[model samples]
Target: MPRRPLLRNLALTAQTVGEHVTDDPVLLALQVSRRLPRAVSERAAGLLTRARGAGVVRALGHEMRGEREAALAALEARRGSPVHRADAALGLGRPDLTAALLEAVAPDERGAGWSAAAARLAAHRGDLEEAARLAARHPRNRHLARRMAGERDTFRGVAPSLPTKTGHTPAPGRVLHVLTNSLPHTGSGYAQRSHSILASLRDGGFEVEAVTRPGYPVQIGVPWAAERDVVDGIAYQRLLPARLAQGQAARLQQHAELLAAHVRRTRPALLHTTTHFTNAVAVEAVARAFGIPWVYEVRGQLADTWAAVRGPEALESERYRLFQEREAEAARRADGVVTLGEGMRDRLLAAGVAEDAVVLCPNAVGGAFTAEPEDRDVARARLGWDVPEDAFVVGTVSSLVDYEGLDTLLRAAALLAPRCPELRVHIAGDGVARPGLQALAGRLGIAHLCSFPGRVARADARWHHAALDAFIVPRRDLPVTRSVTPMKTVEASATGRPVVASDLPALAELVDHGRTGLLVPAEDPAALADALARLAADPAERARLGAAGRQWALATRTWEANARRYRELYARLGVTAPVR
Candidate 1:
């Protein structure tokens, strides 16, 4: 909702297109000469002109099976005018045209937006190598595209368009999903993580059911249903309370009782609960009574998360000690531990959990992200951004947190502003830090250059990624960040933009310095500024890093790949695979 962010988004999209055409005087002349209505503002017309004048029109025209001649004619008609031929090409699926436009644009300037188009084109041609290679270059659109390409290339002619519901062998068995916080509202990390896994498990041929938090609100006027709603061909129990409990614990008890009764009736082979809060523990007690195997997925190191939120003073108190002890007990006793990253695995190992019992399973999105040519114009117009297309844009799509290093990045931006006059900084997600960040930017005399797009839809986050010349993860060095894996890093890498990040341990593993991104010392604004400047100044370096990062994600970080790892772990536990 922040005006700065919306304007920033617009600026980024224009900048993305501009990076490719800025150096081409012919293209520039063509763009500016188009005798279109003066009502068409310089910012809006420039974006459309870049898209058309750049190579996408021919590519999209061919793909759409439209008259390439006619499209070309339209483009030529606006040769010196502000026309939207590139937008038309995008609508028509002209990969060649799009690619032509994007060919000269380095990933740093075009960022994820440009690379995603190329990757999709490669995927359509059944070229897994090209798709995987391209997917690796962009940070935002990695997982889904890579999965499709890999599967198609690996299992082509041997397997169906989709992975078989039932593999050669039937799936191990039913895995019930317990949703303690199932409300659509308050979509915290835990909800997204659980939902993604539920889909993956069901797709991987595990019978799945969900019991929502007791007294949880329904999506609409209708109460939640426990029916055969197909989730990857597996049943889902979408339970919502008609009227429910008072406190958090009380709500958990009611949900547990409901789940206990459901388990008695359904007799699932395994009950997997998500998060460290009351939902899983309550259900674990019931599952124990039922003599069923129960698994817990820890999204974060609870003790660390608590400490991060509460500070050291609280950790020294007896209350905090008890809280830590309880979490440790839960983790110790769980049948198996599923975690977000290697950091959590290390934490569990230190906590005396059996190494074999812990699994590294991070959260992810499903489905490939493809760019729509029409999206370029519509999104640009909607956001009202008009910076000349030739600017260097760096962006981050996350809630503004002190831990996220927005403050550090702001300082870095201030430092780099003098040297990189065309550099623009975008902060997409909003949180408690907004006012202070605004104030800081103003004080730094760089308020005019910062774009704060407040909170954005998860789906919309991609556009923010697409608009950037590079994406950043500015997490401060802290115990929590060191032990935690950020979702944005995964999202950013998948999009194919070069990443500039703190040299935190978890991020260190994810971002290979000089390859995927530049890793700066934590909390060092100068280092961050330098890294950003390096990418901004060198187009080739940004492309190299972005391309390398995208490839790594496709090869190693897809949800399907991660799910397979989890499946192998479940097999070790002797859980039978469910029917497809």
Candidate 2:
């Protein structure tokens, strides 16, 4: 919002929008739907559905809008080129079709019309080197070219260096966190964890405050958001600009400048930033300019997360390769790095973060989760959930995404429906995968017994945990799932609910096989169904596992304990508060 950068940003935004609409209307429609009002969403939807002349645009839009079958059917019915059909199929999540369609077209025959699609396919199917070469051929599409490059490439030499502080005095105890989003406005597990960590640090006597990425709550549809919000005594500062700089690279630079100015004003002694290198790129720059220590929290392997939505092939993609490089770069430059689970610690080491510099700070829980849980039926009634008193409910309260593998849960429910007449699968959360999962449930003929009550409130998280007879963490087997520890899993264990999670390394760290909770093979619906059936049939076994899970959670995972560890870590890093 600074007068100096306003004109430049406006011009860039205009250029970006013009290119976006002209070259990639499919993405433009999706972006408008998410960022704009209802009228625009309707218009965008119509543009795709009625874009009869442009087969590629229509097909891509249909797929992105969660109508995969419609997209594929329309593409198949059309008399489009092989590359056109392949692009549509890929967008529809049909890699098999993409392969088949591409098989008919010679590699040398592919021109600019097919180059972008080929680049994406190569990225998904093979290596980045080839994909990057393919992507670079598309001179008109800057976004696609940048997508294949590393995030550091976007902000190359863009870290802002501010002048020496003059406005505020340095307080050793004051730690400012740079985050992508935060509580109230964004109710993601990421946001929840941010608040908990900030609250923990505040309670531990550090003057902790958070600053969300620029244009955060405002851009995410919270038009009424103020500059500051104090939730549970932990203050969150918003950076709402009238408009964001044009593209990702430009926006990151702008965010860094804004953050640098904030550092000048608040003058914290240490900077702490979480995963996904964007936050780090900005924070690291500010920390350097101010000559203060910074901590990078590797909360998740976000590159692998993006790959999950695509397929296993995406593990070798250009985006994945670039993302990992940037993450490693950020982690290596930090004064210290913190991560969840031993799996993630090993990943950090593998990613080139110094072994001695990184520490394990697993996802943990507190407050109501520390106490005895309410009766399952009582919780259901309190939540106004319609269900039989004797029904055996098995579910999870998590963001419904492809990586979470709720489709596998629905499949398991279908398998258990006939035998376990009292069985109910209630998944509570919302994401891009919800609609597809719901459609899959209906297709599996178990929609009658399944209930997806969307996203739950942060305050009602405990109640949702208690409402289930058993908690499920049926995550897919992927690079991300294997490394990143989920917060909901620990919260579920803490709430005295027997957790049935995938046998990934991260989940294995929380669940002690058959003792604390059940661990099934990832993506195995039959294994999941078998485990759930056993729990449903044996009340005593369920009670025993639940109690053990609670004990394990209390002993190993608590924000209070985590806070002590962090306080100690701060001391070791020379970031502790000075004695009054």
Candidate 3:
């Protein structure tokens, strides 16, 4: 039988659920659509609407037969509703709807809003090739494109899949982190890494106070985060309000100052600032004013970030040059630099910063999942996972992005799928690339051979890690990727999973080719496929590699061990006395 139309079924069910439970149709649609059957999903196309409860109910009840005609005609009815028309066209899966929708679009209309709608429809239909094509064509939709590319990786059986339950809250910490956004809201990989490190610090007995870019329904503030009345035995502080306007930088800065002032009043021994946004800079200025030495975790080449936001023209303009100058000045002025890898440290040194001023704290295993095999097995079993005794389950637990190299894994899976039919590829993440990756798998005819677990919680991250025969990091050789360490590589090693990663120099530091894990050429699907085959043929080699990796993690990478390094570095900068 043809695959069920899960997406269609979901739209219908969600529409029904929305009418019964909530007045907000959009949220209901999102909620109900998630539970729809595959067959229903296909037939329920064009159900997409940003409408309120009434509009959604009306749209869902409308006959699918004349919906396309009605949507195209409605384009003429509304003067400035390209978003509505584009959404309709997307739901209906009509390419012709593009022309009609574009006809009414204003010259200044953000083209991306419409493109996002189209991408959504393509993704819903599991047509990632089409989604990627549309996403890339829309130049302003870089984030959309990146998301789609990442989804493509998941479909190709790469990355850790996250489980979507309600949510998983980590234990509270002693240090308070007053900074910008949280996981999903952050625009870049650096932000994600920063959050991960903060969590690690919390694990190491720091009363970590966190206040994300405020004003979200998701109440991730400290008092609420802590199960006990207090967080890390300290009163939580979350005073900053979420910014309402997108372009009001100066206003946001003023609001950020109030929060920074609160931090200053508290005068925590160590004030860690993560991003270069308004809040971070404010915190830094306050710490400097108080004569507090702050640790500046440099995630990116600031010059590169500035260039990415403003076009090449800004490179020569005084404004761009000034931004770069200030960024350099900030680094020079920072007491101690906490960078991701040696590459960042080397760059800072080359820029004439003193070598001793930098401390390299690449993403390390935080000892979250270092339990015994029986404990891991119990965890996996409780989570409803059934691993075959003989199965060589190779998996990844990362975002399914193009840079993460899901395509390479899919291609490798296709080649390995026939030889090692028992070799199941499990992906533990999701993104816009989902449709593309799924399409690639369908094209490669290995769809049935892959298991997608969506997004899993941090609690279950280790079990997923322990279950894998070999953990893989197939990163593309992008400049952003080259400068960063794959956090999962270290996490997987801590779980004692042998790794098969791309042979990048930064990753080479983590994975010793023959000793710790096998290394494959970047983007070379065939090489990745061959490496997996080699590991599958030799279980003894896999076991040896896994053992070596676990030892390396214990000797060099746990967060408690790393946090002391960070504390010592701060002391050298005259920030505080030793923690002991």
Candidate 4:
């Protein structure tokens, strides 16, 4: 026999043995193929990598690593494989593409994999009955069939049931908020917003209860188990099941079940949830099960955030399409929708949500942020910054993400450094992009002028804000940035600091150009430098903008005002709190 043929047979035997011993058939195949001679191994592995049923595994691996573009490319390369194409389509959140891909397969060739993909796609598309029916046709799809059947049974008889008005005493105003994460675990802007809203609701006399799903404080390595804690007078009930943390689908189903049980016990008058499709889906399920009216608070265009990291081409990818679809579906199903800005509300309206259904509850400042201004010199001293009392300080308290345009800020700082030697930039938040940003600062020769204090504690966040002469929000002009407002900007404005931000709709809504803060063209270091230089040069102007900003924030962006808006929204939905 030819050496190649003999090696191929041996490799296949090893693959079969490996598959029997290990659960990962793809890894086994790759491992076995490596036993062949160099040239043969390379050719065989390359062929197997793009094999009919292997694209799903490869794509999933890429997705797990946050390499969305790579995952899509893997699926795109295997377009001829129905299973791969269906898996890709489903992953992208495109049931239509999945259906099309599966339909293109010959009837005889539609086996377990194709049936499983079809079933999952049906389930994702909110067709649990069809999903269950399709899942039953294949033995391998039994688990998925069970889940689909459970979901169907869970909400089978559920419908919203509002109390009829009687002359009897009114029920306590109680709300159950389902969140993606909370304090002492994650402190992203989403978590901060959730924390602020919960606190405001509680202080406003509504009994607020919050619950977070599994795998929260994601990078913190916390165990998967239930936890209870209170922060700033709001209680959080967490359900972090180990199995749920194993996968996204399992997390959603298990979270819904757990949340429904909590809802039954709490008997909240209404359900409230925020951000990302996952939280909305889980809360929507629980709300439906209990027949409770739910509010979907669209915090940010999460799909655009996910796409921002992947690149411009990601907007056209299946994942982006699915994200938008899921968000729109959540909005359509919710009794009311709340968003961060008018721009976002407009986007939701354009996406077909009823004009009245969407409410604008822009990001607001807590008391700690809007308290009487602290002395900047004292704050700087407390924060351990050794600088001249008159030194020009420009800083931001934000997660160092790419879309934040911190690199652009660094470039701007470098440009201003030549003229303003007393200038210093302090960034007080940490994220995946921090290392790259720091490297960029060093490359720009502004490392000496830049200080990254990592993530500041929420309680201490105001101190950092108070230490700045002018606060900056150097965000890029991305879809997410344009539609979504940043909580930091509100916090900065409330701290009585002038904001210098990109000229985008969302920031522009918050910072009235030249009145509240300076507006600079986005992604332009020169423009940002000019703005920073002008602010650094004129203390009177800075004081003027800062004072105006504080007034604006107090009038429109305080948590007290935000709470009133929510109360009104709830009243419109026939859920009202008793007067204090």
TM-score of 2: 0.85
Task: Report the error of model 1 at residue 75, Å.
Answer: 62
Q: Of the candidates shown, which would achieve the greatest lDDT relative to the real structure? A: 2
* Local distance difference test, candidate 3: 0.59
Write model 1 residue lDDT over 1-580, tens digit each, in one string: 1112233334334433443243122333333333223244334434543464544433222222213354455443434212234333333334455455556455466555455555555543435456557656755655434444443332221211111122122224877777755424435556555666766766787766676654332322223233224434434454433334432344455666666667767677777776664555676677666666678777765546555644455456433454455556667778887887887788778878788888887655445432221233344445666665667878788877667878888899899999999988889876545545766787789889998766777657766776778888888777888988877776677667788889988888788998898889999999899888888889889878877877777777767777797678677666767544
lDDT of 1 at 13: 40
What TM-scores do the predictions have?
Answer: 0.64, 0.85, 0.66, 0.72
Query: Where does candidate 4 stray beyond 4 Å?
Result: 1-171, 215-220, 224-226, 245-247
Which regions of candidate 2 deviate over 4 angstroms?
Answer: 1-23, 28-67, 79-90, 94-152, 155-169, 578-580
Per-residue lDDT over 7-80 for candidate 4, one digit per residue giving the tens place of the 0 to 100 score: 33344344335332332233333333323443563454445445555566565444433344555676666445
List per-prediction Cα lDDT, in the order shown: 0.61, 0.78, 0.59, 0.74
Question: Higher-TM-score candidate among 2 and 3?
Answer: 2
For model 4 the TM-score comes to 0.72
Residue 417 Cα positional deviation in candidate 2, in Å, after optimal superposition: 1.6
Worst 10 residues of 4 by lDDT: 157-166
Off by over 4 Å in 3: 1-176, 181-208, 214-236, 240-248, 277-279, 300-327, 373-382, 577-580
Residue by residue across 335-434, what tens digits does model 2's lDDT show? 9898888988888888788898887878898888888888877898999988887899999999877889888888998898889999998899876676
Model 3 over residues 117-211: C-alpha lDDT tens digits? Answer: 56655554455556667777677666556556654543332322122222222222234455554443332344445555665555555555555
- Clash counts for the predictions, in order: 44, 0, 59, 0
